[model samples]
Target: MDGKVIFIGGGPGDPELLTLKAYNVIKKADVIIYAGSLVNRDVLNCAKNDSIIKNSASMNLDEILDLMEKSVKNGKLVARVHTGDPAIYGAIGEQIEGLKEKKISFEIIPGVSSFFAAAAALETELTLPEVSQTVIITRPEGRTPKPSAEAISKLAKHQATMCIFLGVQMIEDVVNDLLTHYKPETPAAVVQKASWPDEKIVKGTLNNISNKVHEAGITKTAMIVVGDVLDTEGITPSKLYDKEFTHEYRKGQLN
Candidate 1:
């Protein structure tokens, strides 16, 4: 029988956020490979006692491929666990292509991304009428390859609420780039490890975001959320809250 590889999104360092299906699949996995730096150890505890667990934090692409190939060769179901959705910058495409060369079957299991968690943690809606109907998620290009057009300043031109990931280190550059489009007083917030215990939120505008982040001593594992959506007092109520906004889902007032 051909063995299979399961790509599991471990969620934002919180075990409770894991889907029941993911938990079940993990419990039955014969070989589990996880991103040691980000994934919580509590997630690994779900594996069976006899299961083989390995951390991919220090491993190179060849090493990771070798491990998976060896495990599958032994007829063990391998689980490749990632911090969030494996599709976004997870670097799984290369691995999948390698697996294809070896004829290995694989399944991808999506999980709750940090952006959604950040929004929920802040109790702030990403989309609000006239403020911003769209949310853009991107990062400042550094070691990672990004199209020139996708530069932070370019994306900032949209002036839409943005969830910036893996770019805290470049906050100064981020601030400068965003200032080209966003006002210095545009509201922004930095959420460190959303939904996780000890998560921190630092609120400020574009002009002071870096300073606030510096004072908070936050360097990584955080996301930067920017836009007027953070302006709770200045914005009008949602149409759903309007007295005359009738809808089939909920009853509206006649007066």
Candidate 2:
């Protein structure tokens, strides 16, 4: 009689960005479980009146699994909420594997990542045709092992716009690795506590990014972005905005 478990992405810290589907599921969930340290608590308002809300921050893996098992065995709808997109370093793999061993059906719901929201908060585009055409989302290896191919230094060679998560504490290392390929003057920005009312942004270059980050005393809950995409100073007009350029969305008319 156990019901399904739905893992929902809480989408940065802004409650407004949660998808309609995610909201609907939360509203109907009989058991709402969320990552308390990262997710905004205001999101709990969407849950059903009788729903049992639990914060998983204080619980260990076994404890969390036990809660889920009990909920499902009671034929209750469970919503497992995570901050940002659940797929990225959300630590859901181990949990999902455990669920499989217990024969519990589950579904993952995706949400906008913090990197996208950080870029949006700055009103900047990560990909520019010539300036930079690629976006790399990565993190500096901490306790987790990063593949050699995806190492920060190697990925820097492309000079693609880079968004690094869970690596703010190692900003010095990040700056040094990026310098292996990118110029010292390559524009970079750090968004701290992005999308939240107290969000702060520190903009600089590869040379000074680490220093600026340190100056701000921001050690976590921040995203480090690098490349010309953050270069608001030397912006060239986009072809889409050029009147002489024609496109299906806005064709050029005879002058």
lDDT of 1 by residue, 1-255 (tens): 367899998888778898787888899999999999878888777899999899999999899888898888888999899987777768899999998898888999998788888888888999988889999999888888899999989999999999999988778888998999999999989999887888999999998999999999999989999999988777777888788788878778888
Candidate 2 lowest-lDDT run of ten? 229-238
Q: Which pairs of residues clash in candidate 2, taking residues 3 or more apart in a chain or in different chains? A: none
Off by over 4 Å in 2: 233-255
lDDT of 1 at 72: 88
Instruction: Go through the candidates in order and give the clash count of each.
Output: 0, 0
Spell out the clash pairs found in candidate 1: none
Candidate 2 on 115-180: residue-level lDDT in tens?
Answer: 989999888988876788789999998998989999999999998999999888999998888899
Leading candidate by lDDT: 2
Badly placed stretches (over 4 Å) of model 1 are 240-243, 246-253
